[model samples]
Target: MNRTDLTAVVADATGLTTHQAAEAVAATLAGIARGMAEEGSVALPGFGTFERRARAARTGRNPQTGEPIEIAASVAPAFKPAAALRRQVAAGRPAEN
Candidate 1:
């Protein structure tokens, strides 16, 4: 499901209008980003932890030309699902809180 579907679900669950749900969803994502920028990570209980991962510069093979190319170092966002989340996904329903 996409953003619109998610917004609808939020609206149904919270009795909010679709527009309000959309704003909430957007704000939630923005908050995560801001948290990551300032703190390098965000943790949500029973859901997951989002963190920044750093990659070292390295040489990569050019698949088409079979030549080596330099790969730049970078920091990327990563997620590790909480045990509750993993169990919920495995069981096809949310786990008992």
Candidate 2:
């Protein structure tokens, strides 16, 4: 599914209009982004934790040119799904294959 599908689901569950649901979803995502930027992490019980990770500088080969390139360090967002969510997704399937 996609954003529209998600909006529909949330709207149905919350008794909200599609537009309102979409806006609420957007606002929630924006809030999460802002929190991650400022606090480096956001934890939602039963959902997951979104956190920042620091990537060290490294040398990488250029696939096209076969030349080495220096990769600068950076901070990146990471997500670790809650155990309950993981189990829910894994039911009747492999966990993390």
Candidate 3:
């Protein structure tokens, strides 16, 4: 769901004002992103862990030109689901701690 829907759901469930819920959600997301970028990872219990991984530089061929191209190494974000989350998904059930 989009941010608006998420805000509504949170507000309804927590009895908070929509504005407050929206701000809380936004801030939470910002914190997670900032943590991952600054610390290279963040683990959320019963949810998942986000980690930064490096891609090695390599030579690739361009499909259109059929020419070799140099692909620069880069850092990328990766996510590993927590055991609980993985189990929930595997069983097609609602996620729960």
Candidate 4:
């Protein structure tokens, strides 16, 4: 679901106002971004781990022209689900530790 829907759910679950839930969600997203930027990773137990992965420079063919092009290296963010999360998804059940 989108942020608004998620905020509403959080508000209902926590008995928080909509504004407060929105702030909480926004703060949580900002914190995750900050952690990824500063430390290159963040791990939430029983959920998943987010990390920065480096991509190597390589040559790629230009699809239209069939010409070789140089691709610059870059770092990209990635996520790996924890075993519990994976299992829950696979089993179609709620996540558990």
Best by TM-score: 1
Steric clash pairs (candidate 3): none
Query: lDDT tens string, model 2, 16-84?
Result: 999999999999999999999999999998779999999999999999999999999999999999997
Task: Compose the digit string of candidate 1's lDDT tens values, residues 1-97.
Answer: 7999999988998999999999999999999999988999999988999999999999999999999999999999999999989988988984564
- RMSD to native, candidate 3: 1.5
Candidate 2 Cα misplacement greater than 4 A, ranges: 92-97
**TM-scores of all models?**
0.94, 0.92, 0.87, 0.91
Cα shift from native, residue 34, model 3 (Å): 0.7
Of candidates 4 and 2, the better by TM-score: 2
Model 3: residue 8 alpha-carbon error in angstroms: 2.2
Q: Write the per-residue lDDT of candidate 4 for residues 1-97, one digit (tens) a residue.
A: 7999999988998999999999999999999888999999999998999988999999999999999999999999999999989999999996542
Clashes of each: 0, 0, 0, 0
> Lowest-lDDT window of 10 residues in candidate 1?
88-97
Better by lDDT, candidate 2 or 1: 1
- State the C-alpha lDDT per candidate: 0.94, 0.91, 0.92, 0.93
| lDDT head-to-head 2 vs 4, winner | 4
Instruction: Supply candidate 3's per-residue lDDT for 34.
Output: 91
